[model samples]
Target: MQTRRRFKQTKTLSDRLADEAARCRAEARTLTPGRRREMLLRQARQDETAMQIEAWLRSPGLRAPT
Candidate 1:
């Protein structure tokens, strides 16, 4: 069987997500208003929202749902 290549991630998920959102925003700023720019901005929003949800999940006061 062929094994998949595995690599270790150096940055935490939150950090990685933040970096991605920032990169997307920067790229979007450089593009003219259009579908591609809109898509990039949407991705950036998603990354930011994910980061928020992750933080909320990790909060100390949260409990598992029934």
Candidate 2:
């Protein structure tokens, strides 16, 4: 059994995101634990970010005419 490699991000978010996405696609071949976790975390982060943005949009100070 091989150990799953951990990736380090030293570049911009976009760059790191693309690299991570590529890794996830490649890892589907092996079904590695690390890749699964990474994909789930990435999805969670996206969901959280969207929620925050929606909340901000609904705030009185930022809300627009409906």
Candidate 3:
């Protein structure tokens, strides 16, 4: 039987996502206005959205489904 690989993550999910978004935005800034830059910007937006969702999901205000 093969055991699943385990790893420790030093950063929180939101932090990682935020970092990735920032990186994407920075890289996008270097590129001329085009598909690749647009794609990078889109990816950064996705990361930001995911981070927001993750934060919402983890909020203490979240209640269990009835």
Candidate 4:
């Protein structure tokens, strides 16, 4: 019998935010006009947050000291 891997790696914060944004956009596509607008706004905000997180990750201050 083959054993399945028991440990799963967790997603990073930015990845999670990006996934949420994508899911929100996909759900918005199925909604009526008014709800779609609200969902799109939420998706935009999530995308913005993901962008900010990515920027922070690239910031020099967070780098390891040589």
Candidate 5:
């Protein structure tokens, strides 16, 4: 019997962008609102795409200031 191989799913664009932001934070690099908004808007301007951005923001480390 032959078995099929299973591969992990590729990371979504939102996941990748969030990782970029986190890496920038870790490196003490500034993520200005203009840049962030641009990144988010680029992703959020679609049907379910907005949800990914929302999910990213709601992630434990990505919250906005209260």
Candidate 6:
């Protein structure tokens, strides 16, 4: 019997937030106008979170290694 190992790459927080935002937007497209509003809001929040993560990454505090 041979064992196979699967290699998985870890996703960064920004990447995950971006992916979630995309998924929320895609789902919103399939929803009714009334329901879509909530999804759109969720997508916006995800996008905002991603932007915050990116901003944090660029901050001077994070630039230097501890």
Cα miss at 2, model 1 (Å)? 4.1
Model 1 segments more than 4 A misplaced: none
Tell me, by TM-score, which candidate is best: 3
* CA displacement after TM-score superposition, residue 2 of candidate 6 (Å): 32
Output candidate 1 Cα RMSD.
Answer: 1.2
What's the residue-level lDDT of 34 in candidate 3?
A: 100
Q: Per-residue alpha-carbon lDDT of model 4 for 5-59, expressed as tens digits?
A: 7976498667777777777777787778896669696776878787797888888
Task: Please give the lDDT score at residue 54 for candidate 2.
Answer: 61
TM-score of each: 0.89, 0.44, 0.92, 0.55, 0.31, 0.54
- Which stretches of candidate 2 lie above 4 Å from their native place? 1-33, 63-66
Model 1 has a clash total of 0
Q: Give stretches of model 5 more than 4 Å off.
A: 1-9, 29-66
Write one digit per residue (lDDT tens) for candidate 1, span 5-61. Answer: 999999999999999999999999999999999999999999999999999999999
Better of 1 and 2 by lDDT: 1
Q: Please give the distance, in angstroms, between residue 39's alpha carbon in candidate 3 and its true position after superposition.
A: 0.8
Name the TM-score of candidate 2: 0.44
- Local accuracy of candidate 2 as per-residue lDDT tens digits, 1-66: 999999976785555555655564565546656767677667656655665666677678984669
User: Against the true structure, candidate 5 has what lDDT?
Assistant: 0.59
lDDT of 4: 0.78
* lDDT of candidate 1 at residue 46, scale 0 to 100: 99
lDDT of 5 by residue, 1-66 (tens): 999999886997567666655554544334456766565544434524555767877789875779
Reference-based lDDT, each prediction? 0.98, 0.63, 0.98, 0.78, 0.59, 0.77
lDDT of 6 by residue, 1-60 (tens): 999998775996677777777777777777778866696867768697777979888888
* Candidate 6 CA-lDDT value: 0.77
